[model samples]
Every structure is written in structure tokens, then in C-alpha cells.
Target: MEISLEKPIQQEVSVTNTGDLSEIQRVLTELLYVPDDKLKLVVVLELLDYFKEKFSQKDYKINFFYTKQNGNITGFVVSQIDKEYRSYGMKCPTFGWLTSKDFLSCKLLMGECEDFVRKHKFRKIRGPINFPKISGGIGYQTEGFEAPMLNGVAFNEPSSKVLEYLQELGYKKDAKYSCVEVVESNWNKGNNLDDDIVLKFLHPHEIRELRSQILTLAQNSFYSVLADAPGGQSRFEEMMDSYDLVFGNRFVIKDNFDPRSISSIPEFIEAWESCDLNKIVPCCPLAYDRTNGELVGIIMALPNLFQLWSKEPLTHLNVDTVIINKEYAGRGIFSSLQNVGQITSRLHGFEYVEGTTIYANNDRAISTIFPHSTPLRTHYVVQKRILRK
Candidate 1:
């Protein structure tokens, strides 16, 4: 799996989906190669572990496609059809984890993906969507290369050349994602929510206990907002698995394991142990209807753990997701949530908050959610219609 740094020649490449861990690991490690970046190395390891786990599952159809030029692995991509994944139709494979040494390698790897899609009789192929959305976030970094890499999102070298290669190979943009950063002081202080809607920030210890309630709020809010769009109902339904993964596993650690002990990564351990739960407040504020105590709005953000690996003081936050029930949309809950989040973050020494992964065309979120925030980075998930249905 040794990758050559020398110039790649235009040669015929062979593709295979061996699902071999050691080979897959070497390919990913070399592809994601960044000098002296242990954090990125750890990320690669985590992604490998995720693949190892998913590959063992009987319910998933996971393929690891790699290209070989004169028997040397030049590039690789992952394609999968999981019951829970539905960016494309269930029968279509979502392709991701793409890397290539050059244009020819990219074409070979993606050609294998198209072959897989057509053999299975799927109408269209969609992605660059690396699943769980949090890990190696969906798509290639087609824009905002100047933006600093943040925790909980994808980061690839600017010289990777995968995006342009895909475009040249005739893949169209399936979806576009953008992130925005707002200085604490610049955040607008909108009118407070009505007296009937109560806003509260959860204590770190209580997050596990209220996890179910929070998940319910997220589900109800997302469904109401998304169910009206084309294929939105199914997409929302499919996204519940991601919601469960976040709230049930990633956000709230199990009661049995020490939270710090759960992660083998030293930086993550340091980040977790450094938190003085009482003093360092997380800005996960929830708005509830006072009349019936129904959760109506939520704004979630967490400390940027990657800052530790960068040898910087933890002064940044990643605003992951914000959801408000349609029933509660116009009452300033969204603005109030952001305002509260800004104050909480500022009080706890966070200087900046980046609202990330917002859909590019979501005008409501772009215009209203973080109005004062400036653009940070952008990503694009690509697709090609393999069959003329």
C-alpha cells in the first residue's frame, strides 16, 4: 500500500473491491497524508475502524473500490447500500471516501462505482456522502479552501484534485453545503422568545438523562420542516438513524463507561478531561412551550476539540445543528436560541462559533439562522444518472 509521491503517468488502471482492511487502511492513510498532523492520522484510523465495523455487518452491502496501476494501488473509494442510508434510492449505492493520485485514477475508481450501480439495476448514483454525516462529512471541498478546518467535518488537502476530476468525469452537483462563522460580539441579539416559551441549557451531567426528550424534539422539528419537500419525508425518516447515532452514542456517553475512558485518542481524552463541567458550559439550549412543556426549538453546539490537536487553546465552537418546530417558527425562538448560545459561549471563553453544514439553498437558514455570520467553507455531494429511467 506504499503510495508513490512521484508524478503519476497515464497508464491503464485496474479496479477491485476487495474489502481488505490492511490494504484499505494503507490507501486511506496515504491519500489523507498530511505531514506532522497526528490529528488527521487519528481521523483516518477512526474512519478505518468505522469501515471495519460496517463491513462485518450482514445487513450492509459495502464495497471498497481501489485502482491499481501496474499492480500498485493508486486510489480508492467506498460504495455502500445500507438499509438506513437513503441519499439515493435504497437500491442505489452512495459512493464516498474517494481519493486518487491523478485524474486517470479518479476516473477508474468512479467508473468501478458506476459499474457497481448499473449491475444492481439502480437508476441513479448519488454521493460522495460519507455516512454518519459527522465523520468525513458528505462531499468534496469544492469551495472555501481558505477556511480553517474545524472539528466534526471533513478536511482534505487543497491539492487533492478529486473535485475537478469528478466534474471532468461528468458528475453533477447533487447537493451543496456551506458553513459560516460568527464572532461572539457580532451575533445579533434578537427579541426574546415569548414568555410562554422557556429556554434552558442542560448541565453536562443531565444530558444523558434528557437525551430521549432532546431526540424527540429534533425528530419532530426536522420532520415538520422537511416532510413537505419532494422525497423529504423519506429523507427525514432515514435521518433518524443519524440522529440516534448522534444523541444516543456520540453526544451522551453510556453510564457504565467513564466518558474520558471511552475514547482512545489522547487529544479527545484531554479535551474531555479538561472540561470543568460546572464552569465550561456547552451551549445546547432548548426551548420548551411553557403551557404544555413541549420541546419546540433547539440549538446545539460543542467545543471544537480539534483545537487541542492544533496546539491551540480551546476558544472555538462548532454549531452543528439548529431545529425549530414549524408550529413555533415565527416567534423569534431561532434568534433567541442563537443569542443565548452566543452569550453562553462568550461567557465560557469561546471567541467564535461556526454554524456548519447548512444546505446551500436553504434560504430560511441562510437568511435568518445566522444572519451576522460570515461564510467559512463549502462542500458538494455529487451524482450521475447511470440509468436513463
Candidate 2:
């Protein structure tokens, strides 16, 4: 009788560029899906839909690449090239939605990304940064794996070995971010701001009326400090649109007081009445020039609705964005706006306040925004240097 021996399973890794979103979604869902968790899945699918919409619009250069192992989809990454980033320096494209089954797969997929970078003559590659500003996030999860995933925050399996693989593949840390939580007891009630600065909770009508001003404030406040400016009216409107769908009229305007008493504007009353505070406490607090009514600072936060989706008590408020005009930087506007939002959240029974993606080097955010708070989770944005041909 002839001796029979079974051959070992061969390792197969292949990467391809495709427009098939369904396949992309399948791979991502398989990687991220949690049983009995509909909300997280919905958010994931919605983000993919946003990518699809953007692709259809052809507004930006978005490329999708996926890797297969032994004929099974095992990894994927999306590379986005923004025209505006070129003016700042090199057209360093951002790679996001990175998911993979194993370290080998991860390395190979990133190899494909690097090849794309080389082919395009881009100077560097950065990310795991998703986009649209409103729904995207930066970096890979390096700490706090036990913490529940928040909406718009990046997620990675602690055991995936992806970060390690990146390090081995010549990626270095470009930036670090922190997610922080502040409890009611730690509320930093700010010192008195200048008399000419007026802080108030912006009503819905006021938000609509002041949309242009708010966008301007965002652009002016964030342009210098951030890599990407908030840009033109269309981008700001896109963010607002995302906020509306994500929050679902749950934003708390001023207080529990009668709507008519707070605003004479009919639209304001109707909008305020539509909010269901029992579910979540969301607010937009603003500091504006008392003299000219120009916006000086702003803070926006919404309930941690991910808690509800996880079947946990909704007791957390998430501070999404904080912007203080450069001219008014040291006027305590940042702290004051946060204090007001925290007070409002506490009054409505929230137990903790969380802020996401605070850059490690942001001295102003660290010193002024939440001085004493420690990070709940930490993330690192990685980059690779590519030599020009």
C-alpha cells in the first residue's frame, strides 16, 4: 500500500481594489458585529452608506481596497485624498476603516496601501482617520479595550495585533488622542468671564439664524489648531445634517422651563418642545460678543446614545466638539461653556460627561478644557514616510 500524506494548508493573501460595497460591508460587519447589538451595526452601516454617497457624488478621491485569505475576505482599508490637504503641504491621504483577520493579512493590506501611496507620488500616509468630520474618527484603539465603544469613535479588537503589525511594517505614531470622562463631582465651574462676553444655550431657531456665524466660528477657531479646517458652508451643513440624524431631536435647549417663556420665536418653542429630555440630554452652549453678537466660543454635546443601544442606563453625555475663536482664547470661554453643559447634564440626571479625541499635544485642551480628568481610553494615529521617486 502506498503511504498517503496530507499536505499542509497553504497561506494565501491577495489584495484587490473594488467598488463592491456589499463585500466591504460584509467583511467589516463580520469583523465588528456583536450579537444582539443592533445600534452599533446600524452606525457601522450608516457610515458605509455615507462613504457610498460620497463615492457616487465624486466629490473627493476615495479608494477602497480589500484583502482575501484563501478565498475568504479577511481585511479591508479605504484611502481618501482630500484636495484641501495639498495646500498645507503634501497630499497625505488618510487610510480608514482598516480591518483584518490576522497580522499577516494586516501587513499585506497595508502593503497594498503603501503601493498606492507610491504610485500616486504622495509623500506620506496617515490614518485610520475616517472622515466627514461629524461621523469619522482618528487612530487605532491602543488602550481601554474594556470600555464600551462610543459612536464615531474608532474600534479595534485588542487581540488583533494590528498596531503591533503596523509598527513592524514601519509605521510610527503621528499623534495620540484621549477619551476622558468627568463626573458631576468634578465639574469645573469656570471663573467669571469678561462682562462683554455673554454665554447662553442656543435655541434651535437661533441656531438656524446663526448657522453662518457658527460655521465661521468653527472655521476660524479650528483652522490653525487642526489639520483640516471646517471649510465652506457645504461642509458645515453636512456636519449639521449628520448631527440632526444622530441626535434625533434629543438636544436640550435651555432648561426644563416653559418653552414660550424662553423664546418668543415660534420655531424655537416648537423645536424645544419636540426634544425628549427623558431619553437624552444634548445641548449647544455658546459664548458670543455682547456688543456685536458675534460668536466667540461654542461647545456641542449629545447623550451617549450608544449606552441605550448596549442596554445600559443612559447616564453619560458626550462632548463632541469645542471651538473658541482665537481672539478670545484666554477669556475662559472654553471652560465656561463646558461648565454650563456639565451643569445642564447633571441637572438632568447624567452621572458622567465624556469627551473624545482630545489630542495629546493640545496644551490648551489639556490645561483649560478638562484639567484634572484622566483618559478613559487612548488611541494613536500612525503614519509611514514614503520617499519620492
Candidate 3:
């Protein structure tokens, strides 16, 4: 029951699929504390379903590493086969790591990780995925902590110790991303878009029908950068559901009309000094290929603040996603989207807008987003032994 790296990892420890839901909820609530009770339940339900699938199949594993004597759960993770491994005809499959909590020993956790890697003879361990790439993607926020709350924007922030452990085990940056912030200003305007591209707002009722269009564009937009990587359609689909649960209108945050609109950072801070975050306003705009009637770009935004009820205030809005088809890149499509987001957010009285996640090594995306916003925080998608020698 008690697993120690100091002991023989094989005999003293074992990885099992009997991860009870109650135990997981305890660990998640204790360590993660995803703020909203409803959201937390949703997350738990999702995790339960995720573990069920992984454990039921012989080809899968939902790893729960614990102390054998007391049956105390100390570490947890999950993984499954990936398309890349199957396509490559490799014996070492790509497994998406699930989660680990508590102040579990770095050596103990890493030993389990290596064990999982070896058992499946996995080519690499792609992780931090909420579950599988088909449902979610990999990520760990590394900055702007202390919100102590979670909503549709960013979920639970993992402990710095997790990153430390991964680094010690020689885990490399499989993907690096940042949540950039853009203060409300006149500079990043919507006029930057190409003349032929027309921006249209998504009707609340249009989500189901438009999901396909958006998905197609999203797939095309992310293919070069994240097609082989995690967090694509699955991530977007999850966000769509979040839009219904967290945001009032099922598409936008409610109307934002605070009389004390912040004009400067100092003003914003002053407003933050005494304010209650009540009003919410979000904008979801899409750019269509005027020539072919095809959807090519999208920009989704929402009113957001860490620690929802804190003095933090809703001065800043979160840009959930910005995707433009690859064939449409470098055409000011993204810039135009940013501009529109800024204008819409500013009009709603938000002093700023931010993106919670965007890959760091994606120079094209970084360059495109840089002109419209400033990087506020960094998050890493840590991975190891994916590509074989």
C-alpha cells in the first residue's frame, strides 16, 4: 500500500485501475477546488466517465498509484493510444497522461510515469490532458496564480512541484503556451482585416449548425501547429459546453454596463479596489470567406476575472479562442479579430482582454497575436520519450 521511491518500485508499488470516484472527488476538491460547485460536479462526472473507458478496455489504463498498506491514493494518471502511434506503426504508443495530485514525491510519481511508459513501451508520455485528446488537451498554467477559483476560462492550476518533477525527469516542453492580455485601446482595431472577409456574429441558436463550420476551420487552422499535438476539436467542443454553463446567454456573458468604465490601468486598479463582478458581456465573431461562402476565421471572447467574487473586478475579458484557416493566415484575419474583440470588450466596459492559452513555439501564432496583445503568463505542456531514437 505504501509506495516509496527509496524502495524497489516494482515490488513495493503497483499501478491499478480501481480509482474510486469518491476518492478522486476528495483529491480534486482538496487540491484542485474548481470554485463553482456545479462546474466541479461536471468535472467529476467527466473524470468518472473518462476513467471508466480507460479501465474497462484491456488496451487502456487509468493509473492510480497509492500506498498499498493503507490504500491511500497518493498519485493518479491516465493514458490511451493515439492516432500518431497507430499511423506510424510503432510499438511504443503515445499515451495522454491524466492527472496527479497531493504532495506526492517526485521520485514516486516519476517512477510510476516511467513504469507506465515501459509497460506499454510507449514512445512518449503526452500529458496534463484532462483525459484523452478526443475529449481534452494538455496544459499547465504557470503564472498569475492566487485566483483560487475556476470557471469556463482556466481550470485548476497545478502545483509548481509537478513542473519541477517533470523537469527533473528530463521532460521537455512538448508544447508551450501563454495567456496574453490586451488592455482596451484604440490601437488594435478591427479595420486591419482583409477587405473581402466579412465578420459575422454567431446567433445563440446557431451553435449546433455552425459547430461543423467552426470545427472545419479550426481543424484547418490548427493542423500545422497542433494537428499532431493535443487540444484541438475536443478542446473547442468542451469550450462550447462551457459557454452554455458559465456564460448567461449560452453564447455571451450578460450585458456589461458598469458606469465606472476603466480608462487607464490606474483607473482599473481603483475600480478593482471597490467593485463587485456582476455584469458579464462576451462576443463571438466569425469571419466568412466572402468569395466562397465558407467560414474561415473565428474569435470568441468572454468577461473574466480570477477569484470571481474578489476585488479583482471584471476589468479584463478573456479571449477564448482565435482560429483562422491556414490558407487565410498573414492576411490580417487574426488582427482584425483581435481588433473586433477589443472594441466589443471595450464597449462592454471591460478595460482589457486576454487569451488563457496559446502554444509558445508557434511563431506564426505568436507573431500574429503579439501585435494585438502582451503576454501576461506562461504555461507549459510538458512531455517525455515521445519520439524514439
lDDT of 2: 0.66
Write the residue-wise lDDT of candidate 1 on 78-197 in tens digits: 877655454422344778768788898898888878877877777677777665444456567756777656655556667788888888998888778888877444233344447677
Q: For candidate 3, lDDT tens digit of each residue in 6-117?
A: 8534434434544676765565544444535445555556666766655676755446543221344445554445333221123333333334443344456555656666
| CA-lDDT, candidates in order | 0.65, 0.66, 0.53
Worst 10 residues of 2 by lDDT: 262-271
lDDT head-to-head 1 vs 3, winner: 1
| Candidate maximizing TM-score | 2
* TM per candidate: 0.77, 0.82, 0.68
Residue pairs in candidate 1 whose N, alpha carbon or C atoms collide under 3 angstroms: none
Candidate 2 structure, TM-score to reference = 0.82
RMSD of 2: 5.2
**Candidate 2 per-residue lDDT over residues 1-389, each given as its tens digit:** 98769786976788888767787677667665332356657666766887788679766677788888777787888887765442123446778778777888888888778777887777788887766544456778878777656655666667767788788889988788888876433333354557787766544444556777776677666655564332446444554554454443453444556756633534233434555443332357677788998888877665555665566766766676788889988867777666655655564556667788787777888876566565688888888887755
